[model samples]
Target: MQIPVINRSRHALPEYQTAHAAGLDVRANLAAPVTLGPLQRALIPTGLFLEIPVGYEMQVRPRSGLAYKHGIGLVNSPGTIDADYRGELQVLLVNLSDQAFVVQDGERIAQLVVARHEVVAWQPVEALSETGRGAGGYGSTGSA
Candidate 1:
């Protein structure tokens, strides 16, 4: 699936790192480094704009290494970018660790996954059908 994109930053275009990777790595487009103190959050710009197709959306997710090592992650995990949006792609990152984290220009800060979705129509049913574990949630099932 081809999507139209505009890149205003000096960094290279986002791409998948491996053969079967589901997400493409996205970089930060900062002129200088941005430091995030512990528990602090910032909206990092990508300088990228896209025209996603109808019925499709882009998901912005955190990099595992950054999240595990530096406690750097997206404030809204798996953030959804609607197909109609035509603005610059910005990532909301937060430093969850005790120490500060610095985001540099061209650094792979997040990942983007393009996905297709379906719009559901409400049936307005009076009640839902029963299941083997009806109404069971959050540890209701055994760990096994």
Candidate 2:
């Protein structure tokens, strides 16, 4: 599953930290530190461009350590990058804590997961097939 990528940042290419990890750790590429106040969000650049396959997509996800320790997370959790896009990968991050969080250069900020997708054609029908819980949504099943 090798994909073509251009690393324009100062950091090394993204890699899986663990053997069984599904996502690669993406780093931040910045000239200086960018601080985000409580509830403030910013688009942090990665300086990475990818030539993703036509049937594949890249997903930007949040690191659990950052979310649990510093209360920082991605605004668009699992931000999708279509295969056709050839732009810098920027992470939309928000400070969810009461303090300000500084984004340093070459800091690990997010995760990148490349996955294959299916292109479905318009199958216009009168109604969808019935199920045991048809139309059940938003906690309709049960509470945790």
Candidate 3:
């Protein structure tokens, strides 16, 4: 699928990949770094903006290295970017570490994955069918 990327500023670098076969990584600008306290929040901006097509959504996920090395991760992990959103691409990041974290400009704070979604319409039903373990949840089945 063809995705439209908008570079608002001339200095903004186009979306690039860290590894040839790895997913594409988005970077921040050169002005300032988005800061997050021990438990505070920050909106990290991606210089390169995108226009996602309908019936598709972009998932803003944490970079594995950043999350594993540092306790910083997305506030709403796997945040969704709708197709109709036309504003700047910002990542809602929360620092769960004990120390304050600084999201440096041009740092790979998050990763975007485009996926297709279906809008399922609900229909009124009179009654529901039963299953083997009806209404059983949370370890109702065997763990092993």
User: Which residue segments of model 2 deviate by more than 4 Å?
Assistant: none
- Residue pairs of candidate 2 with colliding backbone atoms: none
Worst 10 residues of 3 by lDDT: 9-18
TM-scores across all candidates? Answer: 0.96, 0.95, 0.83
lDDT of 3 by residue, 107-138 (tens): 77777787899999998899889988777889
Residue-pair clashes per candidate = 0, 0, 0
In what order do the candidates fall by lDDT, top score first?
Answer: 1, 2, 3
Descending-TM-score candidate ranking: 1, 2, 3
Using TM-score, give the best candidate's number.
Answer: 1
Cα lDDT computed for each candidate against the true fold: 0.96, 0.94, 0.76
lDDT of 1 by residue, 1-144 (tens): 999999999989899999999999999999999999999999999999999999999999999999999999999999999999999999999999999999999999999999999999978988999997788889977754
Deviation from native of the Cα of residue 120 in model 3, angstroms: 1.5
Root-mean-square deviation (CA) per prediction? 1.3, 1.6, 2.6
Candidate 3: segments with Cα more than 4 A from true spot: 9-22, 142-144
